[model samples]
Target: MRCKYPIYLLLSLIVLSCQRKDQVVKRDNEPDIHILQGEDTEMNTAIENAQKSLYKFKEAIESRNPDYYNFALKERFNTAGSGGEHIWISEVQYSDDKFYGIVDGDPISTTEVKLGDTIEINPHNITDWIYIDKNIVKGGYTTRVLRKRMSQKEREQMDKENGFTIENE
Candidate 1:
């Protein structure tokens, strides 16, 4: 039984070591800084690629042809996320008319709507700009919180300097 205990412990350590080695390395060019800090330097390199095929989807509201973002939303989804993640475009039938169609991605996911505010269905509004960024953050794009921590005192001073104030507390 004593020998069995040490053997069991040894097997556990081996399994753990294997898992550590097999961890999916997420980056190719840069050593993911959060995982292996300061191991690789940043590089700015541009790679050219043509856009992906766009699939037309149901538009919730009619905005004419070009104004509808169903094409671009699919394109953004293809570019930003793992392709198999099942992206779909949805047109919000608005009783409160803020936005019409949204790529089923973050930033778009929570942004509010306003009545009579029609989206012209252009690429700028349709693009899931936060999609890649939100996904990469692991804990879902709480970078704003980190920024608050990093800039709290500086921001507070700036607010005071700029005549922005908190009166009571």
Candidate 2:
């Protein structure tokens, strides 16, 4: 099945901006981009942690807490020769061992999917999951890692833009 969303790019863009200290220009609504190495141990560990704690996200969703909003999941999509990208899906629902959500961002690599497309995802493919509760970020394991990579100023800006606070873990 084909998947879509450039949410990974959006996150990476934030991280990249911090690392490079470069101004991001959004031309024609194009997403700012960042590329991470496959062997980045920290990032890999973050993904693993997110998968391990996925049950918590599922439980929260099942609980139907009104405070929980902006639920999103990240999945890896493989292309023919360009490897794969980790993209985010929003408005997620989980049932019968499957996930349904809309692509939350425009893809930077794969063409099989695009923003606002509905897709089914296997749990094994989920690299990350997140939701907001009371203007605070929860279940954003990868996001925490990304935040750790940012400077204080950049982190503050990111938090302000997202309208959520990601406390230290």
Specify the poorest-scoring 10-residue window by lDDT in model 1: 43-52
> What lDDT would candidate 2 get against the real structure?
0.68
| Overall lDDT per candidate, in order of appearance | 0.23, 0.68
Candidate 1 per-residue C-alpha lDDT over 96-162 given as tens digits, one digit per residue, 9 for 90 to 100: 4333444332222123322223343434223221111111211111112222333578546434433
| TM-scores of all candidate predictions against the true structure | 0.17, 0.80
| TM-score of structure candidate 2 | 0.80
Query: Model 2 over residues 1-169: C-alpha lDDT tens digits?
Result: 1121322332443222112222343547555544566566787798899999999889888888887766788887765565666677887997786789987667766787787899997688788888777766677776776667769997777665655665455
Residue pairs with backbone overlap in model 2? 6-105
RMSD of model 2 against the true structure: 6.0
How displaced is residue 124 in candidate 2, in Å?
Answer: 1.1
Best by lDDT: 2
Total backbone collisions, model 2: 1
Model 2 residue 43 CA deviation (Å) reads 0.2
